[model samples]
Target: MKFNWGNQHKPNLFTLLFLYFLIVLIVPLGLFSAYYALAGNTNQERYLMRQAMNMTTGDASTVAQALESYRHKAYQLSTNPLVVEILKADSLEAESSQSRKLYELLFTVMHGDIYLASANLVSNSGKVRVSTHVFPEVDDLRYHGNDWDMASIINQNSQVSPTASLISIQSHRIAENGRQVVASILRRVYDQEGTNLGYLVVDMYADALSPQVNSDHVLTDMLLVDTKSFYATSLVHPERFGSFDRFPALNTLDGNYTPRSLPSDTSIIAISPIRGTGLHLVGSLSSAPFFQSMENWLSAFSTTMIIGVVLALGLSYLFSRSIARPIKNLAKRMREVEQGKLESREVSSAISEFSQLEHSFNVMIKQIISLLDLTREEQAKLSEAERKALESQMNPHFLFNTLNTIKALARLHGEEDIYTITVKLGKLLRSSIDNRESEATLEQSMALIESYLTIQKLRFADKLTTEVYLDPSCKHIKTPKLIIQPLVENAIIHGLEPKVGSWNLSVRVERAGERISITVGDDGVGFPPDRLPDNLDELANSPHVGVYNVYRRLFLKYGRKLHFSLKSKEGEGTWATISFPDEEAIKEEMQ
Candidate 1:
């Protein structure tokens, strides 16, 4: 009995092909995808960094002009005739009468200035004479407690050499509306004889200094910060108003920086000084959005590679078994024939050569073929389902690539409008695709809608006016991502675009206690008065895509807690409002 060592087993086929497929397909593709995604992310982040810097400078200049104007206004208040008379009063009765006149004058100064929290005339004795709000409460020490000194901080921070620049805006807690955080603009008031008469303190809502020019939501956590004290005006993040030293990474950032040298983990910051204001317009862009698509692409591609490798292993095993099994059977049959028993042993296969071996073998071949056919049918169905899923995921990729190509062409020809539109389109796609969460912060939803409106505004130019008024307080409340967007889209598309005259579209999110109301309205061609559906569920069959979709999704997500309404008149415009419990509000209640 001799044993053939070489024929013991041929381990080459399955193992070799498995390694070959992985090495040939998976390794190279993985490397290429990783490298491509990394490079793409880097380039994108660099571009954002440059754009942020440029925007930061523009914003700084705009703010500088505004602040300088406000400074002149403050000086005007100090020199006003009524203000002077209040300081040079003949007696207590005279001062009292003058105070009333000055008080009325302060209200006049703040009449149309919505940002003016208060205009206080602080006397030399540190007594507040008159203010836009309650004069008595304005002088209360309880508000500016903790021994906070107005004159000390102002005198120390004021750069009065060239001209008296109102103390660069400071984070002041005044006794207006429960001592709301406002930026203080203090100017020295004087009598005719040059006797100093306290300071004229004009409290502007911190929002005045907060960044609002950024239509591109790339920047967040913006601040107009004092260089000396780091007292920041953070409208979006009010808690960050007092001091920024708590944010180690944020505080230590240089006078300015770009993403080129920034670490991946740190925020890409752009800073520009507001001239003569002693403050810097600092804006931060998180690395998340810039690199999210790349990370997602790599993760998805890796998953696909894994699936392919697994399928390759199954294929390799099938090929190996198909070739090795039948040959083993044939060899055994030849050994039996060598013993003079000529009948061939049965074998099963789909190979052409084995089909003619024996009748039973042919029958077995037919059964195997039928089984293979059934398997292939099932496999086909699975592959189809998988392909559809892939197509759904690949849609954004195709559209995004197309947008990039269009943007390049637009830039080449210097088509500013087209380029801007394409850039915004890309932003919308990236924002939608990058966030996979079913729920998002209200602020996130606002950003997405804002991006959409921006493109539409560009298309309409001056003919269309869009205003987004968001209660800074409700920004963090949770909501469905596409919840409010479709409504806004409907306003511009269905309500405004078809109108005969100038269109005005507004999206307002107002917080009322624990709940919020989201309203999207337009002054354009509206549906007939009777067309406004009382029930959105019944309108599933209707043509109102935006309102219907929003209603359905919100109803499904929030059940009866969410109330969606649609109202319109043919001559007037339409208003779609969705009101629901603020998740944060509910949580607070529970707590």
Candidate 2:
């Protein structure tokens, strides 16, 4: 009701209200706008980059698995009985018969993968003996022409070996499907006597090794790089195959492709190698779209600020005191939060808006604390899993050599029993090799144990007798692998093998009130009480390394809940028992 609008000398309510609005809203909004225009974009880009890299990691694993599947196919081709018989054929009748069988086998392998264009058993003499694709007929023989210069490619490969295969970066005609197969996986097949019978030539389509990356990304380029020859083939663009000249940023053609910089427009580049093979996946994401998104964001910010300013121009005089105090209080609390003071709580105001803001802030703090605790637990679980994995590893080469020897001996002596034992040994070795998880069902652990004991019983003949018993109720209970196997192994190796006469070993798994108990005992020589290990550290230095590993893994997994007892007396017997609560019991305890 006052007439202050005409006077410029006296302090007016409009001017004071406008000053308050500028102090309370416009200054802070200006800072917020500047941060959004600059630092916010930088942080968002980094976050997006991290997300893209995570996706790249997953796609890399998929590509690695695909390449591994190809390697397995090559192994199957090498070990096929028909492949050897074809090399040993003495007459045209036998050769033709074996060739048909070889063709069928190749077709079976090729048909499983849609991208496999052809699979062939190529002779050392450059003859395409058998092929999955239709071989052109030249007079009476199949196509003998080096249509893809297959002969020169074979001889030029210096890294083809019994253990290592060579991948060539060359285009092959896919006559059947009319699609181009730009690369070949060539593996040298050799007999047990080290005789090079022939090699397997598997031609795959250009996109066979391509990781089906997210379409959100601008481009994904695949390079098939031979692990031995350092040959790289670009799958996305065929003309750039086998050379890094087109990619000047990467200085070398080697598998270790660490590029200093890629194309200028690429915001991020992720490089993942197809393990155990000659392929590397290179993913390029462009920055153009990110810039476009920021442009839209800026436009939205400008519109929002314009609306806020217009509303403030009209409403400042009415509610300046009501809005400014609550906002300042919230700002103070936020600053405390920024300084790591999560306990600071602001009192609710008489205004509903400020009261609601206070309530939401408190709820957000509680959620943050809850998430931190959950993250810590997950991180701990991950560490334990990694430890379990490290403990399960062994020198795979030793396992392979031992199995190959057993297979060779079984073939030479024509012993079905030895072959059966060899097969069981393979199962045991595979179980140990393939245990990537931290825990297994009680039944799976028992199966691995039975396989081990079966092999032992076959080896010891009349000298070993082993019994394994499991309560029917405990089959589905979760237990870590290597928990029972090492104990069983110790019972057999240290308990029975050194015994002079026939010895007996027994394994019993039964459920106690709220826990599962596993006992492995043997009627064999026992360690002297004085020589026994007192704790985990001493156990590591003792002869029972397997026992040490089991104890360490269990203690790390179950913490204080693990119950282990190792008792033995000289000339009596050795018995080791481990008991721990099952998953349900543990969950109840946690709750």
Off by more than 4 A, model 1: 1-34, 90-100, 126-128, 136-163, 169-171, 210-217, 252-264, 302-591
Listed per candidate, the RMSD to the true structure in angstroms reads 44.0, 43.5
Task: Give the C-alpha miss distance for residue 197 in model 2, angstroms.
Answer: 2.2
In terms of lDDT, model 2 sits at 0.69
lDDT per residue (tens digit) for residues 100-185 in model 2: 67667777876767454467666555344666665322111224344534423354456555568665554344435666566666
TM-score of each: 0.42, 0.46
Model 1 TM-score is 0.42
Q: Tens-digit lDDT track for model 1 on 1-591?
A: 355699657765546655665576567766877677668767777877787677767777877776776676777788887777666652234356666676667767666764545677766555445667665343443355555564233444345542364554454554446545446677777777787766676666655555444546556756677767666666456545566675554544654432222433656777777777677777666767657866787788888878887876677667766766666676666565456444534545698675466456545555666777899999999999999988898787788889999999999999998998898788787866775677888888888887888888787789988888889998788777788888887777788878888989888999888778999888878888677666677677877665677777778878888877788878689888889987766787899
What is the lDDT of every predicted structure here?
0.69, 0.69
In candidate 1, where is summed lDDT lowest over 10 consecutive residues? Answer: 255-264
Query: How many clashes would you count in candidate 2?
Result: 0
